[model samples]
Every structure is written in C-alpha cells, then in structure tokens.
Target: MQDREGIGKIMTETGKIVTETGKILTKTCKIMTETGKIMSKTCNIMTETCKIVTETGKIVTETGKVMTKTCKALTEKCKIIKETGKKMTETCKIAKE
Candidate 1:
C-alpha cells in the first residue's frame, strides 16, 4: 500500500508539472504575439512619418521658389521706382532754370 501511494503521488506531481509547463508556454506565445503587433504598428508609423516628411520637403522647395521669384520682382520694381524719381527731379530742376 505504501508503495502504491508513493507511485500515485509521483504521477500527480508529474501531471502538475506538465500543466504548469503548458501554461508557461501559452503565456510566452501570447507575449510573442503582442510583441509582433507592436513591431508592426511601429513600422507603419515610421512609414507614414517618412511620407509626411517627404511631402513637407516638396512644399518647402515650392515655397522657396515662390519666395525667390517674389524677391526678384520686388527688386526690379524698386529699381524702376528709383529711376522714375531721379527723372522727375531732373525735370523739375530744368523747369526751375
């Protein structure tokens, strides 16, 4: 009887160990799934961010071109105004004489 009880106890302990191992494996599998999901989300975010940065760069380039053209136009207008002012002064001086 004593030997039988010892054998039964060992079998029960072995079953418990197997159950605990199975639970640990299930938990590890869940953790791996969650980690994969997080990695996928991070990659998506990075891809979107790169696209935004590329679009912003294009906008900045276009804006720079527009600003350069506007600056050149203003410079030409200022030169014209200065020349007109000088001509008007010359005309006034001649009339005064």
Candidate 2:
C-alpha cells in the first residue's frame, strides 16, 4: 500500500509539470506571432521611406539644373555689359583726341 501511494503521487506531479510546459509553449507561440507582425509592419514603413527619399533626390537634381542654367545666363549678360563699357570708353578717348 505504501508503494502504490508513492507511485500515484509521482504520476500526479509529472502530469502537472506537463501541463505547465504546454502552457508555456502556447505563450511562446503567441509572442512569436506578435513579433512577426511587428517585423512586417517595420519593413513596409522602410519601403515607403525609401520611395520618398528617392523622389526628393530627383526633385533636388532638377532644381539644381534650373539654377545652373540661370547662373550661366547671368554670366553671359555680364560679359556683354563689360564689352559695351570698354567700347564706349575707347570712343570717348578718341573724341578727346
């Protein structure tokens, strides 16, 4: 009778441990599922950010091209004005002579 009672007690303890282990495994699976969802959302956000950055870079490049053309036009106008001034000065000197 004593041996039978001891064996039953051991079986009960083993059953409880198995139940606890099953609960732990279920919680771990839930945590892993939540983590996967978060990682997917993070990847989507990063993709959108990359697209926006690419568009901004294109706009900046186009704006730089326009500014370069404007600067070139202004430089050409300055050269013309300087040449005209020199011609006028030469005419004035000849008149004084």
* lDDT values, one for every candidate: 1.00, 0.99
In model 2, the worst 10-residue window by lDDT is: 3-12
Report how far off residue 53 is in candidate 2 (Å).
0.8
Task: Encode model 1's per-residue lDDT on 1-97: one tens digit a residue.
Answer: 9999999999999999999999999999999999999999999999999999999999999999999999999999999999999999999999999
Residues 1-97 of candidate 2 have per-residue lDDT tens digits of 9999999999999999999999999999999999999999999999999999999999999999999999999999999999999999999999999
User: In model 2, what are the clashing residue pairs, if there are any?
Assistant: none
Global fold similarity of model 2 (TM-score): 0.76
Top-scoring candidate (lDDT)? 1
**Which ranges of candidate 2 are over 4 A from the true structure?**
1-5
Question: Global lDDT for candidate 1?
Answer: 1.00
